[model samples]
Target: MIFFRSLLVAMLVILSAYTAVVVGNHGMNLLTVFFADMAAIEWPGQFNLDFMFMLALSALWVLWRQGISLSGIGLALCAFFGGALFLSCYLLVLSVQTNGDVRKMLLGRHMPAHS
Candidate 1:
């Protein structure tokens, strides 16, 4: 169960990063786009923030509970992976709303024609 949870977290991070890149390529501010996209779908923006905060807090709590010292690498990974996860989920949701089937099959799938 823990392994699956970790795997899910990793996948979410990758998806979030991909979403951010796609949005950025389309001239959107990653953060604003993420929040707006979530809002449009009736998802609270706080969900993403809260999730990250909880994950970090849980990691810290575990370390403390185990009497383990936190390392810089662990902190870095938490931030990096956590950010990617949040962004990916945000972007994935936004992409679904913005690029429906028609858009995905046509405009989104093709390169823009040069003037």
Candidate 2:
């Protein structure tokens, strides 16, 4: 479990770094290209719609897991705007905090093991 989580952390870190460099080279107008694709008549538009759904879902899940308070809103915004960057970092830290107990790390609640 720890090994897999460590692998994911490494992968996300590399991907994030690469993406940052690419974005830096391209500039913020890259996001305009990103947004422009949403109007396409094929897979790109579909993918963007799917991503938007998942984006909203992630924000809602963040709110659900955290709460309806200030911190909850803050986390939801992070989950909304940060996307996988926030999720990967959040999960890595959460897994560490929960000692790699996947259920507690993911579900935010503990369950009794059946005998």
Candidate 3:
């Protein structure tokens, strides 16, 4: 069980990292397309906050069920590096779309100007 859980966490980290890269490189349109496909299968409505919430919940379940401590091997690396990488890219897109200043605050010197 522990091994399985660790494997699951690793897979999630990889998938999230891949998604972050794709979203950063190709843009949210690609994510929207992926979400659309997901919706077609399980969700009938347009992809929105609800779908995102569900995904987050599902991730939480995996994290919890794995029984790995927050300081454990998988969680530490994923939360520190992989999760940060994924969230940074996602927030960047959100900042671009909404012109939100919070992104600048979070990214500090790393953000590109709106020019």
TM-score of 2: 0.81
Q: Candidate 1 lDDT, tens digit per residue, 26-107? A: 7656567656756775556667667557667644543333244455336444544555564334335434554534343223
Tell me the lDDT of model 2 at 31.
56
How close is every model to the real structure, measured as TM-score?
A: 0.31, 0.81, 0.29
Give the local distance difference test score of model 2. Answer: 0.78
> Which ranges of candidate 1 are over 4 A from the true structure?
1-17, 20-28, 31-42, 58-77, 80-115
Instruction: At residue 52, give the lDDT of candidate 2.
Output: 74
RMSD of 3: 16.8
> Which residue pairs show backbone clashes in model 1?
13-85, 15-88, 16-87, 16-88
1-115: candidate 2 lDDT, tens digit per residue? 7687887788788879988898899866755675678866578877877887898899888787776889989989998887888888888888888788777765663344551
Give every collision pair in model 2: none
The model with the greatest lDDT is 2
* Full-model lDDT for every candidate: 0.51, 0.78, 0.52
Residue-wise C-alpha lDDT for candidate 3, range 1-115, written one tens digit per residue: 3453355556657887787898799887855675677667655444544655655654453344334565333543443334444444444444555456654534434456772
